[model samples]
Target: MQLVDFFTLLFMLMGVVSAVLVAFHPNVLYAAVALVFSLLSVAGLYGVLGADFLAAVQLIIYVGGIIVVILFAIMMSENIYRARFRDAAGKFVIPTAVAALLIAGFLKLFHDAKLETRAGLNAIPTTEQMGRALVGPYALVFQYVAIVLLAGLIGAVVVARPHHGNPESEAEKK
Candidate 1:
């Protein structure tokens, strides 16, 4: 097998293993860490598929942004640390059966499909074109999204801030 194929297999294995850990691990913190590895492996797969922009976004948005927030929340929550998480008895059988059926169906569909294989063709990079479009035609939509995110952040801060105006609130802080 080629180097690219080897790396693809490695990344696929890493992603699958980590995803399983994320799902089944009893510890929430460990599951979150596994989720980070799973996401990073997916980003690696995107890089292997020549989707550089997607890989970067996966790394930045999922791994960097979302995972950090999740980890911070997990660390900050005292209740989460004190609680023990476990699946109820006999709960796995149905989900396992469904997952098996879905995997079988997907495998059968893939085996029956006559998909064209692009073996040696180099993928033309579209990141530059996408950047140009985002800055040019899609700029307004992008700005609106930024504004919405900013508003949400501000709202979160306002809601999370302790009330200081009430006399009872001031007394409770002491």
Candidate 2:
């Protein structure tokens, strides 16, 4: 196989493994860290697919901004490290059914699709076009996303803040 193909497979494997870790890891902090690796793998896939802008955005927005905020929130919260998640055995049936259906649908779609190999598939830099679209046609959507992100950040800060007024009591509680 070619080098690019090898890298593609490696990134795909990394993404899949990290995603499993994100889902199954009991420690919330460890799961968040695994999520970072998963996001990084996705960014690598975007890079391989020649979507440089998307790769950068994935790294910047997800790994850099969102994950950092999540880690900080987890770290700042009291007793979160001692928290344990309980498995809800009864709740898995519906989600498992939906996942099975989705997997089957995807398999069928791939089986029915006609994929042809193309020569001279050059990587086109889409940064300029993407920037223009975001500023021109999708300006409102971009602004709305920014607003939502800002609100989430504020909410995280509020939720992570100590409830009690007395500093000595807060330390004792921790």
Candidate 3:
């Protein structure tokens, strides 16, 4: 196969490994690190697929911002790491077998499905075309998305603040 294909395969393998570690690892901190690695590899795969802007957004939003917040939250949590309280890890046999069967069934269904050909529409999508679509036609939608992000930021602050001295706690004191 071509070099790009080889890189794509390697990146996909890394993502799979990271996902397994994230899901099965016992240590929550290590799992968070694996999750970050998985997100980074996904961003790389987006770059390999020629989604330049998507890759940047993935790196910035997922790897740079969300994962950091996740890791910090994991670190700040006071009671999650006690070994005595950690539940016994469950056996994986039945759930894994079911998941494998479901995946195989989905693959079979996808193989049997056929796409219907439709009338011609313009298919070329370069950066300039994407820019025109985003700004010229979808500017309002983009602004709405920005507003949503701002609301998310405000919500994060509201949720993360220490509420120890709030009126509810004061009422409990009385």
Best prediction by lDDT = 1
TM-score of each: 0.72, 0.69, 0.68
Q: Give lDDT for model 3.
A: 0.80
Q: What is the lDDT of candidate 2?
A: 0.86
lDDT (10s digit) by residue, model 1, range 23-134: 8888899999999999999999888777889999999999889999999999998977555556364787898899999999999999999864536545578799889989
Worst 10 residues of 2 by lDDT: 114-123
Per-residue accuracy of model 3 over 30-122 as CA lDDT, tens digit each? 888999989988988876766667888899999899999998898898765663213654666687799899999999998898833221323
- Looking at model 3, the pairs that clash are none
Ranking of predictions according to lDDT: 1, 2, 3
Candidate 2: give the clashing pairs. none
Clashing pairs in 1: none
Stretches of candidate 2 off by over 4 Å are 86-90, 108-121, 135-174
Residue-wise C-alpha lDDT for candidate 2, range 40-61, written one tens digit per residue = 9999988887789999999999
RMSD of 2: 5.5
Angstrom error of the Cα, residue 129, model 1: value is: 0.9
Q: After aligning candidate 1 to the native by TM-score, how far in Å is the CA of 151 from where it should be? A: 2.2
What is the overall TM-score of model 1 with all chains considered together? 0.72
Supply candidate 3's per-residue lDDT for 114.
80
